[model samples]
Target: MKKEIPLAITFISGVLLVLALFIPHKPFGNLEEIFNDWYIIVSGFTFLLGIDSLLGYNFGKLKRKEKDAPYALVLILSFFITLTWGIVEIVRTPEHNPFGPTSTFSLYFYNSIFIPLQATMFAILSFFIASAAYRAFRAKEINSALLLVSAVLVMLGRIPLGQSAAPYVITVIFLIFAVYFFAESAGVTEPKIKIAYILVALIFVALIYPLGFVYFRQHIPEFADWIMNVPQMAGKRGIMIGIALGGIAMSIRIILGIERTYMK
Candidate 1:
């Protein structure tokens, strides 16, 4: 009865929510907001459960006199200190400043402790990013080499390093590739077309106009920006579509009661 009741609720709720998007009338109009409220309430309960689990685990370590017992103690002390401050603020000055500027405890802990800890985490993350880039940019394969070059150009173009020249450089590279590809194709097919592409490439390389550097400075960033915005955005959209479809399929399975791993 317990499992059946929850599964029935899930199926009904899922179906109604799906229909609500199209219906948008009466109870359906506010259903999404109601679900948000329910989510908050459920998440609060889950958070309490997590706190209980943390306490149990840490206390067990302390009781066992583990090597990391001092760290566990520090964790418990930090949690209680923060929790006590929050509870006191709620009871004493619930109508205080929105930014909590009035509460010294909250302000000091957040600015002096929290901000540094957050910054330290990000500082640590930079090293990991470098490590990932090292692995990705390894010249073991043609694909990896291409990826490395593309990444370097993209990164440099966005940053101050390649601001004035990246776009023109990238264009030159594209022209070279185009000439080579057309030249190779011409060996098999029409000869005149290949000659035209070669001449076009040379002309682009040799062409000179007054104040060309000034023009390039303005256009280069825009060209580099296009590379990121167009091709990269298309790939992002494809991945997003795949994720959405996967989520929908998983949700459908849960609604149909085929997904019951949690019940195990």
Candidate 2:
């Protein structure tokens, strides 16, 4: 009964929320807003839970004389420093804001730590991309070879020299390379030469006219705008619906005290 009741409530609430989207009446229309407020309150508790968990784990490690004790110490120190700084800044500010120009410690932390860490995180992505490309562009198979060629052409097409000299040609080559690679990977053709020719024709037709029109328009026009707008929005909506349902299920479990994992 513990599990069954909560599960039933989850199912009912989820269905009601989904129905609320189509039928926008009083109470139903306000459902999402009420849920949003509930989410904010839950999130505050979750943040406290995270802080408690972090302190417990780090303090436990420190007591046990763990191998990475120094790192844990550093993490704990940094957490406290940031927390204290934030609280002080909030209290000093006129309306409990720590972001004013007068907040020296806030400005110092933002400049010294936050900005550098953000930059370092973004810089790591470049190394990751290089590693992935090295593993992917081995050219052991026809598809890999086509992918390598398309990647090279696309890189070249982005250059000022390629754009000025033969932009259409470069664009067409990249497109054909992509299509051929996709087709070969999908097992559409066995003959490499025939596949290449078909890819070339597809690229020529797709790029030549479009490039000419864009050149005349003198502005960057999106070719896949419909795909971006319609399909992408639909996919996002579906994902959000799934997320809402999952949240409702979890919330029901929490409210009914069915999920005691938190207590542990």
User: How far out, in Å, is residue 113 in model 1?
Assistant: 0.5
lDDT (CA) for every model shown? 0.76, 0.70
- Which model scores highest in TM-score? 1
Clashes of 1: 0
Off-target runs (Cα >4 Å) in candidate 2 are 89-96, 99-102, 164-264
Let me know the TM-score candidate 2 reaches against the reference structure.
0.61
- Scanning candidate 2 in windows of ten residues, the lowest lDDT window is 216-225
Q: Residues 49-106, candidate 2, lDDT per residue (tens digit)?
A: 9999999999999999999999899999998888888887787665646665567887
Model 1's TM-score against the true structure: 0.74
- Positional deviation of residue 238's Cα in model 1 after best superposition, in angstroms: 1.7
State the local distance difference test value for candidate 1. Answer: 0.76
Q: Write the per-residue lDDT of candidate 1 for residues 1-264, one digit (tens) a residue.
A: 989988998899999888888887879988878988999999988988999999999999999999999999999999987888788777888886424777878888889999999999989998999999999998577688578766756775577757566556556555555566556655655567767766665664554231224444555456557778998899999999999999999999999999987673
